[model samples]
Target: MEKKLERIINNYLYEDIKEIQKSENLRNLGLDSMSSIELLISIETEFDIQIPDSYLVPGTFENFEKLKETIESILLP
Candidate 1:
């Protein structure tokens, strides 16, 4: 899950992903409408879970790790 999350972020949104100290702001990583949509789709397909529209917004992600955790939490039935 961690690798998948990292791939989604690095492949779709982040070109400057770091081993440490990456930015917390999605906006800083060029999170426009298209990227957000791709994120939503990739997460849903990869996790086999539907993310509510309310949870897909920038405010919900907080940071890359936080986003990964949220997805994993949803996966843990």
Candidate 2:
């Protein structure tokens, strides 16, 4: 799951996936509002899950771990 998530994020980032730390801020890595939306769509499609509106926030996409946690919570819970 983490690897898939990394691949998804790598699509929008300029930096190499190997250089992106789980705690690193995605926005700083090139995730803007536009790319974020595309990223959300990609994730939903890839995971075949609808993210709740409550989870749609800047903080959810703040870093890799946060995004993974959000998806895991929705999928697991």
TM-score of each: 0.75, 0.95
lDDT of 2: 0.93
Model 2 ranges with Cα > 4 A deviation: none
- lDDT by residue for model 1 over 26-77, one digit each (tens)? 6567667777778778888987899876676666555677787778778884
> What are the per-model numbers of colliding residue pairs?
0, 0
Clashing pairs in 2: none
lDDT of 2 by residue, 1-77 (tens): 98899999999998966685779999999999999999999999999999999999999999999999999998999
State the C-alpha lDDT per candidate.
0.70, 0.93
Deviating ranges (above 4 Å) for candidate 1: 19-23
Indicate the residue-level lDDT of 77 in model 1.
42
